[model samples]
Target chain A: MESSRYANPYQTGFLLGLLLVATIYVTGRGLGASGVFKSVVTTTVEAVAPEHAANQPFYQAVVSKHPGASPLKAWLVFEAIGLVIGAFISGLVSHRLTFKTECPPHVPTKVRWIAALFGGACFGIGAMLARGCTSGAALSGMAVLSVGGITTMIAIFGSAYLVAYPFRRLWIGGKQS
Target chain B: MMGPFVPDIITDQLNLIVGFLTGLGFGFLLEQAGFSSSRKLTGLFYGTDFTVLRVFFTAGITAVFGVIILTSLGLLDRNVIYVNPTFLYPAIVGGAIMGVGFVVGGFCPGTAFCGSAIGKIDAMFFVLGGLLGVFLFAEVFPSISDFYRSGAYGDLTLDQWLHINPGLIALGFTVIAVAAFIITARIEKSVNPDAPVYSFPTKSHAAFAVAAIALGVVVSVIPDRQTRLLERATSVAYQQQHPVERIDPQDLALRILDRDNDIQLIDVRPDAKPGDRLPDALTIAVEDMFGKGWEHELAATKKKIFYADDTKPAIEAATLARILGYRNIAVLDGGLSKFKAEVLEVPAPDHPLSFEEQMVYDFRLASAEKIKKLIAEGGKKVVKKRKIKKVQGGCGL
Candidate 1:
């Protein structure tokens, strides 16, 4: 099916850039996506295992900063909510809002899903290690031309290209040539 | 009065609530653009999907331009915004590590939250991994504490470092974004030649137009608030110049004999009749404060103002002095009624203190000496106490 879900990369990028500006103008801060996830994880970990959360320095930081309230109370969380709603609406309009495994033509569907899970885990750990993910590092970083952000963007894109060949089987799909 | 409304008016708790609400909107927008999928985010690497690159670059440029404009027009203070510092080793190492993580994990922290919100189970696990990652970082924080704090530069903006106007920098960034857009579009087309080209109108285009109008309005209105605040300051400067007049009882008594030292007692009361002048005083009634050309009279003579009714006349005198920009305005310690009480009405002591009041005054003087000693020594109070006693009292205290 022809999906209205996809957008022109340049146009979308420009739109996102505008949104970033709006966020900073009104809020005096840049857009942050990973921080929301960090808050969510911190809050959930704290709730499910308070002792464990307290023992960990990261969770403790979140807890101390938000003594009376949940760590989930953050600008990133609200922005993330908007992101999902907007994406969903876009997907629905494009007829791309469906549950299915998206993978390379050659790869088995289950393997693709497994790869997605593992990939997601690595992204989570890496974002925490770097203090930001793509949105924070590459986008917001380049906005201000922060050296680290530019460096991270280059490293991420460079590394992806360098390693894409090895991981080609997971994406290219079909029986191996 | 102008900026940071939420934190200024409310408690910090509300700040958190505002942060969360703003974040929800951010995440929802990101997810709608298909940022939740690892394949989508990683497309930039393989030349297949460039959505991440496009959206992010656009957003950053838009923000940079908006900030520059707002700051230039004086509608916003750029200093109030946050700018990330550039760290050499850590950022590089950490970024390299995160790059690997991005490919393997697919969802960045933000996208993961967005993914999870829409019932993506993988996102939940991704978030779990992020928690563990942060925990690990914290546990090892002590060893790396020096490294994290090693970068000594405090909050430097790019404009200062680069020695360029921020507006120019923003323009350069916009040029770069536009260039990248062109190149990425070419790459995207070449990579997926068979796919149908998709286009969507940008939401921010409309938002920017609205922003420009709003900023224009704020720029025009700010001067008015500044002018009003300045006017209030100028009026206060005028009152300090005028001093109040004094009525000498000796002069009044001597006025009966027409002595050479008879006081020139000018009356400032407003209710005096045309023929109701005092035996030794000239009348300048209170109601004549503004209407009877006191401005010229006060300006011409350096005589202090005196009145009999109450502090009301003194206040009026001060107010007039302020408006007339007088610098020597002063008030009588007591009005004419008090003068009469002291001179003709009574033979009482000027003051009477109770025993407790005297004791309190003495105590205050002694404490003042102790405070003076403390101040002279730079006020470093070193309390000496036994360590074990403090430990024993800790449980109860």
Candidate 2:
């Protein structure tokens, strides 16, 4: 069987760009993902620790910003749902759907899983601080030439490059690929 | 209909639908570009692949060009579009932290969603970890909240900061993007000699590069719709060609006394004092002619009489209205100054007046008193300024 191939980078990028343009033109806002995580965190807190959530300034700010609605009923939340569906469809068509852990040959699956979790945790905290993840602040912000967005973009990639050497083992094992 | 129809033409509910559809496209494109794979995404850091750079730069530049073109063509309103607010320290610090996250996690939030959907177990764990991180942040929110909002700069753009035309910035970005693409492709080859070489078709790639640059040039050459129209409206030649119809103060006074519902008075003066406004007149700035709310007033069947301190501004406003496709628009001849002198403060003739002239002068004297009383009464009934709706947007909760 022929292996599934990725689409050309430039072609995919152009399509993504057009989609963003359409999004901005129609809704007057850009695409976002981290906001979904924010919604989830806020809603969970409101549900589990209603008293604490009410008392907390952070929760109060969020609640006041979006009054008279469930946090889950946000625009980003709906977009995230659609994102999952779209990715699932793409995976199905490409025959790349498999329940497997991807790690370098020398790296153990347990180690990779731990690393992934730690990384995800770090991303979650960082996105909250940054006001956006890559898609939201960086890409969307760049299209609009937003100063904050561009600043974050530079910091994320620049820092990633600076730190990549130290975290080399996680991807390439003991011997560099 | 202009773009960004949300909350006006496109209801909030429909806007959500638009969001979902766009998100679907976003996910599909990301997955197709191999962003669903951690190794492929992380490869940019390792120098094994530059797919992320290529795709990201291309996409960003494309959208920038698209926005500029749309705005230049008058299909979109730049004013209402949301530009992300800048917080200097938060942006830099948060970005640095996100960078660390990217290196450790192997996927940003967006790619993580796409990655997990493809049944990647590591991605699922990442998602769970992300949730924990956010929860932890919320728990410790009070401590960090101040830092988060420390460097608040509202809706600032790079062009504004640099104090350059947006077109020049766009052009510079295009040049930089194209250069990065070429250089990155070369770096990718040197890093892994045995890796599959992605051939760039010379003709098509060059053509696209040229086209992108051409768009930048086009944007730089053509001013935005508002500026272009304003320039044309104010030009001596254009004004001469498009002479606005004018109504005398006597006619306007008579209409005001009669309370003519068919005529709508529009005060375009920037510094119009209280009680200076004509009765039933709505105040709309000349710049605000392009905004959304005044469409009904401008397009109404009732005649619109634009007035300012002098005839120049009123003529300019009427010409702008005409240019924007409004009809039955006329300037108040000699403006409010003329009206105040002729109608409100009519002077008695020194010489004996002809019978017809005396009768007209007597009519003006009586009408002036009635008009003053009507204006005084109209002042008590406040005319609310039309609010132009601003669309709310950001990544925050």
The candidate maximizing TM-score is 2
Q: Give the CAPRI rating of model 2.
A: medium
Q: TM-score (chain B) for model 2? A: 0.92
Write model 2 residue lDDT over A56-152, tens digit each, in one string: 8767877776789887777787888888778878888888888888877888899878888888888788777878879889999998889999998
Q: For candidate 2, give the lDDT of residue B82.
A: 78
C-alpha root-mean-square deviation, candidate 1? 16.2
In model 2, what is the error at residue B89, expressed in angstroms?
Answer: 0.6
For lDDT, the strongest prediction is 2
lDDT agreement with native, every candidate: 0.54, 0.84
Query: Tens digit of lDDT per residue, candidate 1, span B1-397?
Result: 1122323343345644555555555654566567766567767666777777667766666666656555544354444445555555555566666666666556666776666555565556666666666555655665775665445344456666776566556656555655665577678778876422235443654464355445434443443322333343235354345334443553443342343332334456656443333333445544333221343344434444455455446545545544435444444446555544433343333567589976755554554444334333432332211111100000000
Clash tally for model 2? 0
Per residue, candidate 2 scores C-alpha lDDT tens digits across B214-236 of: 88887877776788999888887
TM-score of 2: 0.94
Best by DockQ: 2
Could you tell me which 10 consecutive residues in candidate 1 chain B have the lowest summed lDDT? B388-397
State which docking tier applies to candidate 1. Answer: acceptable
